[model samples]
Target: MPEGLPLSHAQEALWFLHQLAPDSSAHNTGVAVVIRSAIDLPALHRATDELARRHDLLRSTFAEADGRPVRLVGPDGLAGLEVLDRPGVSDAALRAAVEAALAEPFPLRERGAFRTVLVRRGPQDAVLLIASHHIASDATSHLVLLRDLLRSYEPAAAGGDPTLPPLPGTFDDHVGAERGFLASPRGAETELHWRRVCAGAAPAELPADRPRSAGTPFVGDVCRVEVDPEAAARLRAVAAESGVTEFAYLLGVFQGLLYRSTRQADFLIGCPTTTRLSSKTREVVGNFTNTLVLRANLARGSTFRAAAVSAAEQLRAGVAGIRYPFPLLASRVRLSGGAPLCRLTFNMLNATGSDPLLGLLLDTEHEDRVVPNAGLLLSSLPLPQLGGELDLMVNVRRSADALAVEFRYNANVFERETMRRLAGHFARAIAVAVAGPDSRIATARLWDTAEPARS
Candidate 1:
């Protein structure tokens, strides 16, 4: 009706930022799907060529005109997909190849939007490595692309021609629509409100344990900590009794953990918002996320339940303020000038869909993720499909042997391990909050890795 294809709201949002800043949130995470299969050099090439022709965005890149950035689409100049040839190579070999392929620096200019590097591990074992710069993509995009490509690779799944449903509007149309909306009176008010909320808020200044280097320093320090089954049960009851989403309850627990660990009066923590409102945006994959700083000021003696409720209310309010960007606050808010809004970020994603590599069913016996960067990364990875079951991973600096909250204040401004200890502390907090008043959650502690004792 409108044009080639109408981008869902999330796609439009990403396109909006891609047009403005080529290095926006769109370029945050890169997805790598390790596939082991005999390389069909000719077949794969044909498929990739078709894919590049079918999706213009995948072949497009950013260009500078009069010092302004613009999207440039044309015939892609990508290399032919190769086989890594690692037959006897250990799991570590496959992993290192994937990481090396991803670590290759991408220039912001030219048609460097996305590229696929095929490592031929062996005749029957090869990894399909795809590394796309985030400026033009998101995690959902990766999942969708991977899933679609796998479907196409199926022997029975139709061959030759690929037919995509007609799109209602082009990405540019959505961009125009958003531009018109941002020019409204309500839009201006949204700016003012955020200004008030963030006025004088200072960033959590965290110094690297080691000397810093130039260029974008990716602090991918991580620590994996899990709560035993019994502690998880206790947390569930407390979350239910508190009447808050696990996110909110966890936020409260996390804040208390950070405060107890760092003793910082005020600080900001970052978290990713799905930002997908309607079903279209939700299902249509792309980066439709906004990062917000969850500020906490723990009052001494405040119960964990009270702290959790406070955290819950703030998240509710913050998510509603989607139109406000962190950068906009720079123009509106006063005080704490030039300080980072947040140094730590949290992402709680629940993506359950057709496995990206369903067709080529390669035996994925050993799987590991490489996220070597993030000042502080917290991920609630895909777990068993059950209501009470959840796995929380806290990855911090290995040498610092601590958590992000710990680095809030200490030898520098925070100590790392203390923050990690707080991650455990949150579980303890939830156990306490949800434990009935007559019962003591203080006694209900979370045991990591192994099983905890019963009362």
Candidate 2:
């Protein structure tokens, strides 16, 4: 057992946020799966126990050692599962139970950072809820955990050896690599690159419908933005013609939206980038995500195509410097009023060819076999509201045929109608830009009425 293990740079940033608001469940990352089949209770229990044994992060807690946060990995065989068999639970009741479980905060110094709850509704129906603090997991980790759980349950239920293959690497190994990188010459170069990129960039602030005061709690609400298949196809065609990926083109569109709404020519937007640079750490269940501050500079009288090309260039540069930690950059690059540098962020979760990690884990072969082996049918359940940390987070999920854009905004800062208007304007901007790629951004129609365009 390792002793006095330091938290990774990402974990340290989460720890600081946890300290600021200890009771907030905003940092929880989780997934819920509905099962429509008879389950083996004992086997599933054993599977959950095995999951804790396989990953040390599932049995870990945080504490202060000499005025610094350190991870304390506990012994194996920690049963993190809670089984609740309700014979006559309604759909609303089941949803309420899952929400309560997800909203429960973890006392970092006392209990483990993982939670598993099995709410059995009937003989052939159940919902499995798994959640962990962001310090211990990421979006990809949820898929990894689900994969391992099903792998362990199959053998345990059949009265055979339930042993699994050893992990490629541990989370501690990732931490060691990060520490070493920060001390290397490459790390210095990465930091210098970020310093220059963020030297004169102003904080990107969206116009809020309500007044924001100090010490507002981080409560949030989500609104859906619908994009038809035709629009999606047109957007993709425009992206290819512009010589940029769909992500870059969409990011440029978002920047154009901000420019039209707020008229900020130069600002920063937060972009989350993956840090699983090697196969060794790819399968490791930990926080392997880093935020990259992408600068969007729209010169006066520039076209939408020019904005996208600039975005592609800046995105290429930003990803190159992703090794520099956000918290460290926050300390070094001082902004006025102590505001967060990247207040508005853009994220894309594409079903095809966007996220390789998720695509690999939830591939057709694995997805087909996992549930049916237990005589189960996967059910669609509403995703849990795992709160937000930014004023506005625009997530674009691309499927095979259409794009689903969701805007998650702080309820304390903006109203629901405001988000709806923003979404409408976003759709309009895309249509205008793709229709006339050479038109001046200032001439793009944002509202129904015609006004004198700025030069």
Top candidate (TM-score): 2
TM-scores for all predictions: 0.71, 0.92
Cα deviation at 359, candidate 2, in Å, is 7.3
Residue range with the least summed lDDT across 10 consecutive positions in model 1: 382-391
**Model 1: per-residue Cα lDDT over 1-455, one tens digit each:** 11133333444334455555554322334455544334446556655555565556666655555544455666654523545555677867766876666655555455455666666555655566555654555556565555444434443233444333433333444344445545788668776666665666664433334433333223332333544345444654676788886557667776655555445647776665654455444334334455666677666655677777878877876776665555445434555645556655544432223332321222122244321111111111211111000012232211111112111222222245644554555545545555532332223344453542322
RMSD of each: 9.3, 3.4
Off by over 4 Å in 2: 353-375, 450-455
- Name the lDDT value of residue 214 in candidate 2: 69
Give the alpha carbon lDDT tens digit for every residue of 215-300 in model 2: 77777788877665677878888889999988888888888778877788889999988788889877678888888998888866
**Highest lDDT scorer:** 2
Candidate 1 residue spans exceeding 4 A from truth: 1-28, 36-43, 76-83, 155-160, 166-170, 204-216, 278-287, 330-337, 351-455
